[model samples]
Target: MTSSSRALLFLLACICWVPVTAGAGERPARIVIDPGHGGVKEGAKGPGALREKEVALQIAHRLRSRLEAAGGEVYLTRERDALVSLTERVEMTNDHGADLFISIHANSMPTPRMRARTEGVETYFLSASASGEAALAVADRENSEAPMSRAARGDSTLALILDDLVRTEAHADSSRLAYAIHPRLVARTRAADRGVQQAPFFVLSGVECPAVLVEVGYISHPEEGLKLGRADYQEKLAEAISEGVLAFLKDTRRRDAARPAQVAGSQTP
Candidate 1:
């Protein structure tokens, strides 16, 4: 072959031999972290008046840092102690097209006496009815936003329909996500494992992707409340949560890779 032709053919061969990396065109996974309650809504109050909002935001910031370091894009619904509506939080998550949505909060019991008895980490996914009485109570507290309308608070037919659709589309993934993170959170903090449950948390509803709300610990408990206020403990919680998220994402990617590609014009009943 002529020198010029040989050179051209070699270049073409190299081009054809180039391999596409996994996730070549995929954008970094986007995660939306909603720190529960702020501004006038101090949420639950613990010993020494440690507000749930403050603790949630602190943990969220730490979680964001950890997730970012691990190559995920993260956004917080409210960076400051401002009142962000539940609708606004969901809108932010949907607008970002997040791969995962996590709402963070600290748990509190109805009475100081109950607080003393209860201490643990629990995660929740959206559902029409709460898993049990405890879950229902938590949902009621978390869903109590001042700006929410009476209709929003009530069990309207439309709301039920929407909830059903959300559950149908995201329930399995949401459950997996809750299970994935809850164990890590408990192990890292050496806190009690309250276990994962389903509840109708307003902040978690209407999210486009897998969504979960985590009660990292019971701030109402004297011992647990004090531990939650520590920077080292917060760091441990953040690290564990981040690790769990990474593991879930990796597993999802693997599952997707294993699935057969859909042929054009294919239909399923």
Candidate 2:
């Protein structure tokens, strides 16, 4: 098939996956979006002077508008070029009782050679560390600013997973959320698929709701970086991500409705 043919197919698929809205009696889902970095902490910058922080915030706004239109209560961690701590971000997500939380960021490479050679999309859920060196490196960069992120020991991953299970059932749903969002991103953007991964991302450490972090694309790659800076391309990214979240919510609502409701004082079984 031709490149244009494939692009057309993706656009049609996006249109088909119309976002499901809340019914008359159903409460709208709450979503919290965190744009990676801001203020002096501008995230990765690359070709065309594309800055991760700027792109992330722009995408967040687009996503918020899309989700709200689809009957969701959307909240952004930071509305402008301001810095917000990981704790603050998670606090907002939990306080809002968000059904889902998404942190948006752009990836970067350490060297010029690697920058030119690498570019793709990677979606991640909280994990101590997995997917080997690349994921670990990505985690390290994202976690660099989190004061205690570096102190975690190797075995701490398992411990954290167990602890998270007790804290919130969202831990289990997180991977499902990651898988849903990642494939849609790759399909719509036709970007290289780096596959779903997991790492001990400090920002996700405190989230009390289902959460996933998206490394939308490598800002360091010349071609992709220039595209990332474009408003039209950013809108496509937002639209694709919105589709994924809505699909996942649709499934969640179905499962919720299927479960037997508890009586006035009886236990759920």
Candidate 3:
């Protein structure tokens, strides 16, 4: 961005806040849920032949139902085991003017030992660089299926990312959204809290609203994999995710509602 454009964005950032309303409140929350990996990308398989793609779809469907029941207007990127490009997913979110965008997938490890030992729930919001090596690895594998657009890559990428973050205030909101949801997931599922991290997730790029990617559990984990394949467990996962999303939306509304008052108070000096 040029100096003028940067100045404009910075000025807007000083005055902007997007309030998230409840589905049954003033407006319904428009949510886009993406079930990652389908078609040729079968993703990982577990000891019982449980597939990541299948598990993700199951959870997505369950999540959709729960959100709709709660009055949120939810849209799935792919309703079934269908392949959806990363670009298409972003387009759908933009087209719907979504309040939130969440991509769901099962986690996996590269080796048997790693698979056996690693089991937990993880959540992520987008960033220019990853929080650490492990988070970067997760982002890399997930991004490998679809390379990011040229603008999202290359040496000038950091500048571009910062520009977008400043323009949208999405980075800050996305982090808050992740923090609100991660704990509920761990509490509801009784899964290890793998903790939240930020990474350069391709699918999360360019989303107009707060976006997050959730790694529900390790599909390669012997016990967790079996649990993931079960209907009851899938329901639990869906229930937890829906609760988190709704909670975040409500919290966003509360936070934004107070923001102007805080700003006005600060200006009184």
Candidate 4:
């Protein structure tokens, strides 16, 4: 072939050689939001009878609105004052093939005195062991509804070890999601930054995708409790969470796009 013809042919060949990623035109990510506690299972109680279940549901509703506006397909485990099992929550998330799971709750200390001293937001992902006393305590309180028998707990430990590879990746993604959300939550609410943590939260276990449990604030704290009861504050919390979710999803999409594709080689005829 002439030099000019050969160059043109090579360019066409190169264009044909490019690999196509399977999910290049994937739809917007799906997300599951779990509002902690409901019905008879009211979560922590604050002064003026402000219940965690009620606050969590409100936040979840607001978050769903924001996420939907950002082009995410959002699902909430519970939309009202109704009890939902932890297993059911996990199943819902997996069934939807959600990209992320967020469990929302208001925190509380053991005693009124302790609650007064503690005020802030902390995010957590599943782990066999908690990051610290506070994380363990939070996990314990959250797990109370779905208490695992000693045998079940043992089985869960084994499952964690047996599925190490899957769990490790999920854990890493969960941590990244937590970090992405926690900072914005703290900034928007102007709450103390309790930082991200790891804990054996039953609600977060067995999720197929990155999952996190967020403690928005201490409901037992006199001042923070009042804030948690306010509709305006709840809206702010929802906005921050939505921002974080969009940020994480954007990063995930970028990483997926940068991944190397499997190129199919042509055979000599």
Question: In lDDT terms, which candidate is top?
Answer: 2
Better of 1 and 3 by lDDT: 1
Q: Tens-digit lDDT track for model 1 on 1-269?
A: 89999999988654322211126677778889999999999988878978999999999999999787666789999999998989899999999998899999999887768989999999999887789999988988888883463356676753675556564647788988888899999888889989999987777777889999999899999999998888999999898888788778877777778999999889676
Better of 1 and 4 by TM-score: 1
Pairs of colliding residues, candidate 2: none
Question: Can you list the residue pairs that collide in candidate 4?
Answer: none
Q: Write the per-residue lDDT of candidate 3 for residues 1-269, one digit (tens) a residue.
A: 89999999877543222222342346778899999999888888876778888999999999999888666788999998888888888898999999899899899999989988999999999887789999988988888776554345663775576566755777788888898789988998899899999888878977889999999999999999898999999999998888787777767777676785545456654
> Which sequence of candidate numbers ranks them by TM-score, best first?
1, 2, 4, 3
Model 4, 63-178: lDDT tens per residue?
A: 99887765667899988899788888888999999888999999998776797799988888887777998787788889887767424578567456535734467778898899
Poorest 10 consecutive residues by lDDT, candidate 2? 13-22
lDDT of 3 at 212: 93
What is the lDDT of every predicted structure here? 0.84, 0.85, 0.83, 0.84
- How far residue 178's Cα lies from its native spot in candidate 1, in Å, is 0.3
Clashing residue pairs, backbone N/CA/C < 3 A, model 3: none
Candidate 2, residue 61: lDDT: 96
What ranges in model 1 sit over 4 Å off? 1-22, 146-153, 156-159
TM-score of every model versus the real structure? 0.87, 0.87, 0.83, 0.85
